[model samples]
Target: MSEPVVAVERLPHALDLPLPAYATAGAAGMDLLAAVSDGRPVTLRPGERTLVPTGIRLAIPDGFEGQVRPRSGLALRHGVTLLNAPGTIDSDYRGEVGVVLVNLGAAPFVVHRGMRIAQLVVAPVSRVRLVERPILPDETRRAEGGFGSTGTGVRSGTDNGGFPASEDREC
Candidate 1:
């Protein structure tokens, strides 16, 4: 499939920082940088959350949306992660893209200028038209069952019609 063209606007403060880009040919996301205007680092205490600015805006296509995700390296090494992983950035939005990062580690993490804080993944979006109906248009064997309706581990019963049965109830 062909890639969509995303128009990115770099603000004055972010002129020195590199624009978001894919690290590899097969990468799905573009690294978003932290545009610290005054060149001062932002420190996040343990268990604290903050919105880090990117100083850039995007003009996403009408049928697409930008998904902000956390960096796996940061999460595994420093416990820093985006509060709302896969945060949605609608196409209509024209403001600077900011990431809500939280520190889940025992020590504080410092966010510096041009640091790769998060990633932006542009994806296609589908708009559904909802119609009121008394019943769904489909049916399934596990209708209305949720949570741990499936067995915790290996099971030994036929009450579920070959499907895993809940702890005390048959499928």
Candidate 2:
């Protein structure tokens, strides 16, 4: 299938920076760079959060949305990640794309201008209608089971706090 086209406009602050692009042929997301206006790095103290601007606007097509996701390298190495992971950019949004980054590590993290801080994934969105109903039909074997309803090899009778035990099978 042909790739969908997304229109991107660079603001004055990012005029010299390259547009978002995928790092590999099979990558699903395009890297989003930090566009700090002053050409200086921004430091994020531990337990702190800040909004970093991308200095660019996108014209996403109808029936699609932009998802801002965290870079795995940053999260694993520095405990830095998006405050609102998978932040959604609706098709009607017309303002600059900003990333809310949080530092969860013990040390401070620096964000330099044009640094690859996050990634943007354009995905198709499904519009669904909600219908009010008095009662819903039973769906499946796991219906209304809530969390930890499926066995995870945890002693079988103890509370798992809705989390799968270490011995849980990989999905």
Candidate 3:
């Protein structure tokens, strides 16, 4: 097969980590297990938790991190959500990559082969600086009121807080 476009480094394992067919193009944010191995993805009844393995560890370059995100199809259909969603694996981390997933659905949900459980995106990060603060000026009328304090008023107010939480038009 052809090589991938992104710059990535593979780690040496005690045994070779054979790439799953579905994960060839990329890790595709998920891994398939030959059998149900402990901590290698399991189904959960209501209020159950399981871990899904990626069978790989990366030597990420400096100034970058690998973010593990939930698969949209899995979340929408099964109501399965990553317990610690969008978990980050730092450049310095050398451990195996895995996702902590939970079934939020009322019934048992299975995590089967080729199920896109999570995503891995390598991105650059910024180091923030800290400063002691003096009182800042009011940026807007809704300066302090937070967490749904601003009602959803389309024709009446500046923000409607539209359904499904529209990301655009941040106040």
Candidate 4:
């Protein structure tokens, strides 16, 4: 199978940095780099958030969307992650890609130019034709139950808002 080609243009500040690319053959996302001016670094204290620029514009084909997601290693090690995780880039958007990063750890985090701060996953977009109806199909066994509708480890008989009153609470 062939990969979809996405057109990209690097802005002036990003000329020295490489374009987003997969680190391995089996990787599902392309690493997005931080394009701070002149390869400069930006520091973020704990609980601080900033918009880190990618300095690149993309031409995502119609029927596809770009997803900006946090790197697991950064989140697990430093508690740094994208604020609006899995931020969506619409197909029609032709502007610079900026990552909204937040430091959730006790110490400060530094973002340098060419640092892999996030990943971009291009996914197919399926458009649906909405048809509103007063009534829908028959109810399923777990209809309308959200959140912890499924039972937790402790199997108590009482319904914890999610479980039905008469239903069995067994896991």
RMSD of each: 7.3, 8.3, 9.1, 7.1
Per-residue lDDT over 1-171 for candidate 3, one digit per residue giving the tens place of the 0 to 100 score: 343333333334313444423445655454323223435546689888877666566777777787777777778888887798788988889877777888888889876543556767666789776542233333566655566777653223334333243333313
Per-residue lDDT of 56 in model 1: 96
User: How accurate locally, in lDDT, is each candidate?
Assistant: 0.88, 0.89, 0.62, 0.88
> What is the lDDT for 3 in model 4?
74
Assess candidate 4 and give its lDDT.
0.88
Best by TM-score: 2
Q: What would the TM-scores of all predictions be?
A: 0.83, 0.85, 0.64, 0.84
Better of 2 and 4 by lDDT: 2
lDDT of candidate model 2 versus the reference: 0.89
The Cα RMSD in angstroms, rounded to one decimal, for candidate 4 relative to the true structure is 7.1
How many Å off is the CA of 60 in candidate 4?
A: 0.5
Residue pairs in collision within model 4: none
Q: In terms of lDDT, which candidate is stronger, 3 or 4?
A: 4
Query: RMSD (Cα, Å) of candidate 3?
Result: 9.1
Candidate 1, 40-88: lDDT as tens digits: 8999999999999998999999999999999999999999999999899
